[model samples]
Target chain A: MYQLTTVTKRYQRGKQTINALEGVDLTIATGDQLVVQGPTGGGKSTLLQMLGALDRPTAGSVSIDGTDLARLSEAKLTKVRAATIGFVFQSFNLIPTLSAQENVETALVPLGVKPAARRKRAAEALQLVGLGDRLRHLPSELSGGQQQRVAIARALVKEPKVLLADEPTGNLDEDTRDEIMGLLAGLWKDRGLTFVLVTHDSSIARRAPRLAVINNGRLKVTERTP
Target chain B: MFFTYLRRELRRRRKAALVVALGLALGIGLVITVSSVSTGMRDAQDEVLHSLYGVGTDLTVAKEAKAEEGGSAPQRFKIEGREDGEKASETDDRLMPLGGFDNLDDSVVDKVAAQDGVATAVGALALNDIKFTGDFKPGEMKKEEGKPGSGGGPRVGGGGADIETETFTVMGVDVSALSVGPLSSSKISKGANFAATDTEALKAVVDSAYAKDKDLAVGDKVTIKGKKFEVAGIATADTGASTSNVYIPLAQAQKLADADMKGKVSKVYVKADSSDAIPAVKKAISENVDGATVTSAADLAEQVSGNLSTASNLATNIGKWLSIAVLVAAFLLAGLLTMSAVSRRVREFGTLKAVGWRSGRVVRQVMGEAFANGVLGGALGIGLGLAGAWIVSTVAPTLTATTGGEQPGGPGQGGGPGGGGIAQQLGEGAQQSVDIALKAPVTLSVIVLAVVLAAAGGIIAGCFGGWRAARLRPADALRRVE
Candidate 1:
């Protein structure tokens, strides 16, 4: 479960103050899949950054599983990001120099996992994402869809409590996008994990059980889908 | 775990890593080569100095402008200088009544020998008035002539005039005390050395090189000041060092120079009990003898060798500083290269931090790569230094010179007037050593220092790059690249 109480985030760009998220308030219960829909520069990614403990709010608090993210130190925040949240970017940020399995193993390095166990867990994660035979394939050697699958495998390798995807299907073809959406929905239902997807596309937002639209730096609840 | 990531990065960017390593290596090589060459030159100069003043003779005592020989009343010879006057003029107060030029009394030698640190003291008279006579080829004497007045060598004839007799440098030593001094048995090359029991007969020993060139063997008779002397033996010395062609008894040399310096020695070879005691002995000799120009062998060595001390100083000071500047530049170059590399990979590091990597871990990764590069550079530098030394030694040029200590055929030397052979023979002191090869042997300490420097350069470069990496915010890094 996560909760945000009027969280605000601001940045300084050459003497100008830009409000990334202005006193935004939101909350999601356990096992909730909230899809945040927004136009370009709508602060949806900023909101996701706060929820995932990647950035601290200028004001207000973000509570995930009853622990306030804004009050946590940088060290504790990193720990929370490691154990509680997983991120998937639209660019499929898989290290190009590493193999698919090695990319997944990166998530386990900071956790002090032994190499043997880390490799075993990484392989299983890749297999779960239908990249079982692509263990040794580099990002450049794989298709865009396959690279996205590898990125997803890397995020899920740690078995985090929440999954944060920022336009995960924005770079994929329609057929590959449908497959990825179905896969994410199936994982959400089977594992009862909180899924927060940030996207500007209404087609992608329809797949979520709950939808929220963001304009400027403010958020509003749109609809609840069954 | 950091090593795992770093290893991959290095493998992926091998060309860049090699560049950084080579830059550091070049700096290290230059440092080692310059230091070693300078150090080697210093050592070689010391070796030459050790031979010049006689191996164990730590101090030498002489009278200024004093080795004057009497023609009839024994007071005609004296070097022309501010301290010396015409010994022939009895009214001149500057000229000592007796033993004017380089001639110090036996009593002064005894006093120096009795000093606290005095091990053994012997006396020798430098006489450059003598010449070797044998069947000679015409023009050979002119070709084998030594230059005069180099490194304060004996003053030959005032001007130029070839004498019928080709003159040679000569030394008169106390026969009984020669055993305990620098002219020990080791200096004898053939026949036998002058023994302690050898009386003051007409006996003499010729330097081996002079003996060979003159075809004069042991037991051959030679004439000095018209007095015949039996050649007792042959001796050899280092090429650049000053050694008279003939070594005669102290009494005979005194008689040859004349009555003015009679019963006195030209140079008192004092052997100190220890090297550290030379200074104390010098101080003691100065206090004991009046008007004596007492000089330590070290000072004499410096005075005798041309441009050696200056060259050593320039290399150690100027060359060392230049090498240090190069090393710093090498460090900065490596830093810049690594910084450029890190800038290009900012996104990779940003992703790593977003996952779970701490800032310290990333820093360690950078430093580790730098350290590796540094170690590789050190290895390359050492190899380069060795190769450079080899090339220098192999391509060195040979030089011929002489060590001229005394010239006797001057205005009043043994009453030889207008005889210019002294000027012709004075070039003997300019070491005839053709072996001018520079030995730049790399020492262990220098090697260790160079290796350490290489590693330090790499680590310093890594620190610069790591600082930039640590400042990178994960949010901004993620947004920079696709």
Candidate 2:
């Protein structure tokens, strides 16, 4: 569970202080799926960054399970991200040189998982992502959709409590995007993870149980049935 | 995982790695070659000094020849059975002490030997044998110029006369103390060495070149100042040139020299107790022994000239600076290239960091990659350095070293019958030189230095790249919106 109290994030662009996020309060319980929608440069990603523990708010506190994340050390925040949060990027940011299996295995490395167990778990995760036969394929050798599947596998392999994704299908075709969304929806429903996704697509937001619309560093939320 | 990532990254950027490695290799190869060649130059210089000063002799003591009043006197030849206006043929051989070095009292040896740090001192007399044969007719006497000792006597001129001259050097040795003088660097190529008891036995050691020139061997008789002495041995100098043509007992040489040289020696060879004692010993001798100039091996080395000296200077000066500059450039090049490599992998590093990789871990990965490149470069550099040294040792030209000596006598000075004056002969006597083939010997220390430099180069490049990787914020991954 996450709680944000009047979180405000600011950026210094030259001499101008740009407000990336204004005073905003929000709450998310465990297994809740939230979709954030906005136009480009609308502070959608900034809010997600604060929620992911990737950046700190200028004012107020972001607490996960009553532990204030804004007050934790950089190292502790990294531990939180490693053990409790997983992130999927828009570009399917798989290491270009690593094979599919090796790419998935990197998430387990910081967890101190033994090599044998790490390898076995990585293979099992790839199998769950329907990429078991493509384990040795590099990102360049895989299709765009297949690469995104590998990224998804890398994220979920650690079994984190939270999954933060930014534009998960922004670079894909409609068919590929729907396929990846379906896979993510099924995994989220089965795993009961606290999922926060940022996107500009209204169709993806329509499937969420709750939607948050952010524009010019301000936010508004509404509850809806999927 | 670290090794696997390092190996894969290195493989992906093998071209960059090779460029860095080759740059380092060039610097390392030049360093090794220059070092080896410098060692060769030192060895050659030692050989030259040993040939001049002889083995076991750390220093030498000699007095510079002082100028005589009204210049040197002209040579006079006495011809028996000579009639006025009639042609006469005569031959004369004058065995006199060499002119450049004046005689020092025999007690100077004892004075030098008694100095602190002086192990022992032995005296040697250097002489020149001038044999002249000519046919001439006595001409009318004329009043000479205002030079001292120019007697208006029968001047041999105006007649068909030809004079032939032959000159060879001779060194008188202390038979009992031969281990510290010119003979120490020579080996008896044929015949036996001088026995300790042959101090005044009228026996002589002949140089191989002189012996070969005169068709003389051991058991053959050599005449000096009309006195015949049996040749006891033929000595071959370890270096290219021998110190003298013949060696006789010191007492016998004093007997044959002028009356003033009766109980004197031209040179005193001194051996110090240790190399570190040479400066003190030289100082002691210079302070105590009046009119004596002390010369150490280091002083002699400074006088060495020709290709060996030039090569030594080049190796130490230009070669050293060039290697240093190239090494610095190589290090900088490697650092910049590694930093550039890290810059290109920013997205990848940021992704890793966002996936819960600590900044320390990311830095280690960059460092590992750079270090691997460095190690690979080091191995290749060693191979290149060894090959360079081998090529130098095998193909370098022979280097010649000439000792600095006094200028040859000017024309019309000490005018002889038909030859240059005795002063010119003496000047030639001091100019001894030898040719040495250069050999570059690779030592363990040079290889160790190369290894250390290689590792240092790698770690330095790693630091450059790792600092950049460690500074990347994990938010940059999603912030870039790629």
Candidate 3:
């Protein structure tokens, strides 16, 4: 479970200051998939960064599974981020030199996975995303859909509690976008893990059981499926 | 994990890393070149000193004769078993410190030879002021200018050399020790040595340099002091300041220089069987020969021979400073290169920090990369040093006391390939060859030192790079998003 109370994030560029996020209260239950829809510069990415422990809020308290993120040391916060969260970026962010399998294995590296087991686990993770045959392919060698699948495999390899994806399928075609959406829905349903995705597409938001729209650094819920 | 990152990183940025490695190599190469030359010079100095001191000659015995009151009337004698009336023999020759002009009795050689610990005693007339037959005048010849390594160490045969004024260090020895005594180290480059048994042939064994200058060879007859001598052989010796250019029988040198000096040797050099017998033999010689001064090789190197001492000092001190300067430059060059690399890889390092890698681990990864550069740089430095040393040595060998000491009535004075000046008035001089051997002083110790220094330079650079990487904030780094 994730809880945020009166969260405010500010960005200062030289003399002028911009409020990226302000006065936001949000709660995410365990095993819940929430689709957050927002216009450009509405601070959805900032909210996700705060929730994932990648950034600290200027004001307010953020607690994940009962521990306050603001009170944790940098080292402890790093451990929390690695252990409890998975991140999927819209751009894929795969290291060009590494193959699809190595990209997945990178997540397990910090977990101190042994080489033989790490390789086997990485292959299995790729196979879970229907990319077993593309295990040895570099990111550049894969299609946009296949590349996003490799990114998803990397995020899911460690089996984290929360998956924070910022426009995960925003760069894909409509057909490939639907394919990635199906994969994420399948993983969340099968593993019973919480998935929070930020997107501008209303079609992406309509597919989620819970949905919210962020505007001017404020959040307003559209609906929550009973 | 650090190793894996290091290997891949280095391969990816090999061009940049090679720039840093090559910079370090020049510094190490310079150190090697300077050290080898310095080391080579030191060895040559030792050789020259050893030769002048003579082989197996533990003690050199010479009769010291002079008056305390500045007059010849009063003399001091320290002979152990001596009569009360006997006075010291004094000579007017100030340049010859070995008392070559003082006609000591022939019985002194016998007395020294008969000592208990004395292995063999050879008496010689060390006449340094003897003139040769070629020079036209005294003041006409100055040092030849613009020659490589022309001036250094002590000048051979003292400082007052006039190339036009024919002069030679005439060391008339007992012919037996010519090949067995001090001259034994003299390698004969072209011809053989004069027969040790041949007593009186008035034959000369010339220095190879002198032979070349004079166009002299075996069976060639040359006249000095109205008497002609056949050139017997050409040989080389390692005599630095005391290098003798002419060697003849003791009897002949005595006859040519002074008819009244027969059966009188200026110095008797005694060789002990071993180092242990040196003190005993010295004691015996001191007791038997009155007013004799005995010197060993170590004493000759330290107390005497200014040229040898100067050469040794230059070799040891100069080389050390040169190596240090190069090492400092190597460190700075490598540091600058690695630091630049750190700045360029800002995003990469930041990403590493963001991905659950600790600050220490990131620093270690950077340091490992620097260490790899050290390995490559060290190998290149060693190879470059060796090759550079060889080239420098081949082109122009460094001057030692022996090779540069002789300025002469030089080996280039007469003959000039076709022969010019006729043989002049009667004088005594030796024609022993001048042999100088130059080699690169690249020892195992020097190689190890070069490698260690190069590696240390890399480590220092790595530390700086690590420090810079460690200071990077992961959040700020991740903001770059590259």
Candidate 4:
């Protein structure tokens, strides 16, 4: 569970103080699926960064399980991110040099898992993502949909409590985007994970049970039926 | 996983890695070559110094001879049979007190030996034996007709003379302390060295070259100053120049040179307790012993000139600085290139951090790649260094070193007619210039130094790249890439 209060993020761009986020309050329960939707430069990614513990808000309290992430040291925040959060980028940011299995295994490395077990778990995760036969393929060898699946496998391999994805389907066509969304939904349901996704596609946002629409650093949440 | 990542990364950037390695290799190879050549220079200098003062001698004490002090004097030979009305007469003349140096009392040796840091002090006399054998005919001098503007003088008519001069160096050794003089550097090639009992036995040691020239051997007799002496041994010098043509007992040399030279010596060779003690001993000898001029091996090394000295100076000055400059440039290049590599991989590192890899881990990955490059460079550099040193030793020309005769106004300079002009012509036939073959020997220490330098270069480059990686914030990195 995450509790964010009065979350404000401000940055400078050529002597202009742009408010990336302002007075935003949010709560995400365990096993909740939240989809954040916004246009370009609309603070959707900034909110997701706060939730992922990848950046500290300028003036706010972001709490996970009653622990304020904003008050934690950088090293402690890193540990929290390593153990509890997994991130997926729009470009399917898999290591270009690593194969499918090795890219997934990197998520388990920080946990000090032995190499043999890490390999076994990574192979299983790849198999779950419908890329069991593509374990040795580089990121470039995979198509857009297949690369998204590899990214999903890497994000889920660590078995984190939360998954944060930024524009996860922005780089794919309609057919591939629907296929990736189906895989993510199935995995989220099976594992009962808290999944937060940032996207600008209304088609993808329509499927979320809760939608947080952000514009110019302000947010509004609405409930809907999937 | 770390090694696997490092290996893959290095393979992907093989060309850049090779460039960095080759740069480092060039610097390291030059260092090794210059170091080995410097070692060779030192060895050659030691060889030359050993020829001058022998191996055991640390310093030599001698008093400079003045030109007008009878150090060199014209010799008068009595031509007999002139009163018997003989037209032609053959004369043989032998001159002593050779090499033209004033003698010092034997007490100076005792004084030097008693000084602090002095291990042993022994004295030897350096002499030159010149024999003149020729025919001389007596002729009458008549009054010469004077030209209108010329001076009138008596001139000899129908007189002719033919003369032949043979000269050789002789060193007198004190058999009791023969371990620190000219004879100390020579090895007995035939027969044996001077024994204690041969101090007054009229025994002599002939140099190998001198013996070969005169067809003399052990047990044969040679005439010196009208005295026949038995040859006890034939000796060959160790390096540089031969010591002397002959070695005889100090007592015999004194008797032949002068009747009043019973307890006098021309040169004193002093050995110190240790190399570090040499300077102090030299100072003490100079301050306490009157009129003594001390010459150490270091002093003689400074006087060396010609190709060997020039090469040695170049190796120490230009060669050393050139290696340093190349090494510094290589290190800067490596550091800059490594940092640039880290900059190019910012997104990859940021992704790793988001997936829970610590900053230390990211830095280590960068450092590991840099270190691998360093190791590769080190291996290649060692091979190149060995090859360079080999080529130097094989292809370098022979170097010649000449010692300076800078003791001005000293012996034999102002001798009247028939006197040799330079001391080199009289003093031990000292070959002022010596030829030495240049050798570049790569010792174990030089190899170890090369390894250390290579490792240091790698570590320094790694530090440069790792610092860049460790300071990167994942969010900032990811945002920059986006």
Candidate 5:
């Protein structure tokens, strides 16, 4: 579980301070599937970064499983991030040089997993994402949908407590988006995992158990449609 | 864990690794080759000096002009200045009352013989411009016989061309008398026991030359300046002081040069009881026999050793500069490879950071990759360097000369002749080359230096690449499409 209390992130640009996140508050619980929806530059990515502990809040506290993000050392935070959070990006973010299986195996590196068992687990994760036969292919050789699936598989390979996906379906076609969404939901349901997804699609937002709309560095809760 | 990272890095950058390895190999190879040849040259010089000079003489005392009543002492002697006041002054000094040269009388010799640590003291005399005539002819003299306005025709067969010869003072010892130090043995082209003190052996050589030419026989006459003496015996001298000299009995030589005036001899050659006694003998001779110069085989050896030290230092410096050049080239090649790898993997590094890998880990991976390539490259380079050294030593002009192969006369020659005579050609080819090879050992040190240099170059290049990769921000890195 994680909570953001009145978070405000500011960037100094010459003589002005740009507010990326302002007075934002949110809470995420175990097994909760929440989607944060906003247009480009609407602070959707910044909010996700704060929730995942990738970026610290500038004005407020972000506590993940009761540990404050602002107080943790960089090394300790890296450990926390590795063990408790997994990331999926719109561009897939799979290492272009590594095979689909190796991209997944990279997530297991910080866990001190042995190479053989890491490969086995990576294969299983890829199979779960319906990419069992594309394990040896590079990201460059894969389509946008398949590459995103590999990214999702890499995110799940480490079995982190929380999965943070920023625009997971932004690069996919409508049919591919539906398929990827189904796979994400299936993983959440089967493993009882917490997922904080950032998307611009209202249709994708309606499928989540909860929806939070962020506008101008501020977040407001909307009714759960599903 | 490190090896796994290293392995992956190598696999990912095989082409770059290959290029670095090849570059290192060429660099190391050149280093080894040059070092080996230089060392070989130094060693050859040492061998020739030992054979020619037998460690050399320790000291040479000659008349100093200051010892004379009213002449300034000259710093050095000049062969063409006998008529100069400097020569007259030096001769006067030898005859001065208080000078050490005057103290070399017979009483002085007896006193030095009685002194502690004194060894056998045989008198010696030295003269230049002596002429010898015989069935055997000397090499053609290059000096001009007469001035243009002298109006004298070149002297013909009776006088023959005046050949300058160096004559040594010889001691009248029996054939069994053992010469000590470097003079114990002689290197002669033909005829054995030519150094014998036995009158019969000496007479035999003299008689044989006389049979072919009347002027060369025992009792036959040869002239030194205007003084003529009956030929007594023919003898060969020791390698140390024999190359340009002929010797006769000490008493005879002194008598011929009028050097026994005041019952004194020109110089004395002292033979130590053993090698260890040489220093003590030299010291006693110096202290007791004031006007005479005392020399030891060991002192000569030290001079040779000093020369060897200088040569080795020069060689080592040359090798270091060459190795530095090689290392720089290797570093440049390695840097280029690293940069290329980094450029290609910008996105990969970003993805790793985004996946929560620390900057340190990414840097470690990059360095690990570089280290792996470096080690492999260094090893291959060392092997190539050794091979190159061998090839160079075998094919190099100086080495080929030392090995007794004939000099390759021109570019068109397929190969040159081979044998010991060829070594003589090498001697004439380059004086410094022979000196360098004669004194130094070439193989082991050169190889070790080359390998170490290559590895160090690699590590430096790797660190540069690692620093660049570690500074990249994940957000910005990910934003790049490629």
Candidate 6:
């Protein structure tokens, strides 16, 4: 479970204040699929980052599993990120030097898994993403769509309670985007994963069980299309 | 976990790691080379001083008159006063001047000889003059015909009427009583046996007469200042005393030099049976033998050893300073390179931070990379420095003229012939060669330290860099086009 109370993130740009997110309050429970949809510069990514514990809100409290994120020490927050949250970046930010399997294994490093078992778990995660044959391939060698799938595999490898994806299919073609979305939806349903996705495309945003529209620095919640 | 991080860091920044290693290698190599050279110089000095001085000498009875005048030639003084005066008068009053003495009374020799730890008591005589012989001159006919001989004649290029010879000192030692062995024999016209005869026989030989320039050899007929005798044998002294001296029986030397007397010996050599006896023996000699100054081999050795040690210390200090300079330069260069590399990796680090990696881990990874580079570079530098030292040593000229050889240049001209110049040059060359050898040993330790420092430095730098990187809001980092 995640909750945000009157969170506001502000930045200073050469003597002027820029409000990236202002007075936003939101919550999501287990198995809930929440999508924050907005145009570029509408604070969708900032909201997702705050929810994922990757960034601290400038002026409010973010609580995950009832632990105030702002109050947690840096090390404790890192542990929280490692144990309870997973992130999927739009660019599929897998290390180019690592093979697809190794990219998945990177998440296990913080878990203190022995190398062999880590590798074993990584390979299994890749298999779940239907990239079993491509485990040894580097991210550069994979197609854009396939790299995103590896990213998804990495996100799921830790089996975190919350899966946060930022424009998961932003770089893919229409057909590949749909395919990735289907794989994500199936995993989310089967594993009862809590999903919080940031996207600009209304079509993709509509697939979520719930949607929140962000305009300026405020959020407007709306029901799912179905 | 540390090793794994190190491995990954090394793999990721292989080039930077290499640079650090090279810097370290250079520093270590230099240290080893310098130390070796310093050690070698010490050993050479020790050998020469030890061989010449022996364990210790009891009484150096230089003539008080000559000591006052500061003449360079060797002199002697007589021991006098009550037998207890030998023990009681610690002052210089007991010394009596005795110059050019060849033999002391047998009773005097026996008296000192009876003292505890007195190994052997022998008299010595020293004389310096030009040596001339037939080999240095031409035959009568050749002299008339104008052919130059091996003889360095005074006349221009003819077995000249007279020959000019270099001034040489003949030091007569009691070969029969010598405790130390000969170092070389080419310069000794007669074998050492010539000096091994009894006192009377030696006296008879020295008292016989012969021609001034007669050629002599083992078994050949010869004479000392007109006293005739058959040559017995020849021998050489140690390098320290090699410049002067032909060894002969003490009686023979006294007879030849016309220096036999009742209460005189050139100097009394006293050996303590063990090191502990030195002080006591010296005390006895000082008390019993007036006008004699006692000295120990340890003191002489220390004097020589000190000179070498000072030189070595200077060299090592110079080397250390040089290494420090190099390390500082290396650190700066490495720091600049690391900073640049980190600048380029800002995005990557930010991604890692975003992916749950801690700032400390990022710093460690960077430092590990630096350490790897340092180790590799240091090994290489060490190899290069040793090779350089070896090559320099091989090509460099000798610093000193070895004993028994003519130094190639004039005295004080480092390039001079048969003088201190050669030894000095050789020493300098050795110093330089060792400087090269030192590169590796010095470089290795330096490199190891440097690399470790560099890694730590890199980590600190990277920590600051990583902290800055981690402070960035992820959305801004991801949104930046560059």
DockQ of all models, two decimals each: 0.50, 0.68, 0.27, 0.73, 0.31, 0.38
lDDT for A96 (candidate 1):
75
TM-score of each model, paired residue for residue: 0.77, 0.86, 0.66, 0.89, 0.63, 0.65
The most accurate candidate by TM-score is 4
> What are the lDDT figures for the candidates, one per model?
0.73, 0.84, 0.69, 0.84, 0.60, 0.57
lDDT of 4 by residue, A1-226 (tens): 9999999999889999999999999999999999999888899888988998889999989999999988998888889888899888998888989999999999999999999999999999999999999999999999999998999999999899999989889999999999998998898999999999999899888878999999999999998865
Better of 3 and 6 by TM-score: 3
Q: Order of all candidates by lDDT, from best down to worst?
A: 2, 4, 1, 3, 5, 6
Candidates' chain A TM-scores: 0.97, 0.98, 0.97, 0.98, 0.96, 0.97
Q: How close is candidate 2 to the true structure, as a TM-score?
A: 0.86
- For residue B477, what is the lDDT in candidate 4? 77
How does the DockQ of candidate 3 come out?
0.27
List candidate 5 stretches off by more than 4 Å.
A12-17, A133-143, B1-5, B11-15, B18-131, B134-340, B383-392, B398-442, B473-482
lDDT of 1 by residue, B1-482 (tens): 56666777788888888888888888898888888878667656655544545666677777766333663353343222322322221111111211225467878888878988999888776666533222222221123236564454433333222223354656677888775433542277788877766657888887776777778898898777777888888877553333456778877777677346677776777788998888888898888778877777556544543345555666789878988888888899889988888898787887778787777877788888887888887888888877776675676423222233443333234222212212211222222231234567788999999889988987998898899888887777875743
List model 4's recovered fraction of native interface contacts, to 2 decimals.
Answer: 0.67
- The i-RMS of every model, in angstroms, reads 1.4, 0.9, 2.5, 0.9, 2.7, 3.0
lDDT of 3: 0.69
Q: lDDT at B103 for candidate 3?
A: 52
lDDT of 4 at A103: 97
Look at candidate 5 and tell me the lDDT of residue A91.
Answer: 80
Worst 10 residues of 3 chain A by lDDT: A89-98
Report the C-alpha lDDT of model 4 over B189-232, residue by residue, as the tens digit: 99988998777878999888788888999999978888898999
Arrange candidates, best TM-score first. Answer: 4, 2, 1, 3, 6, 5
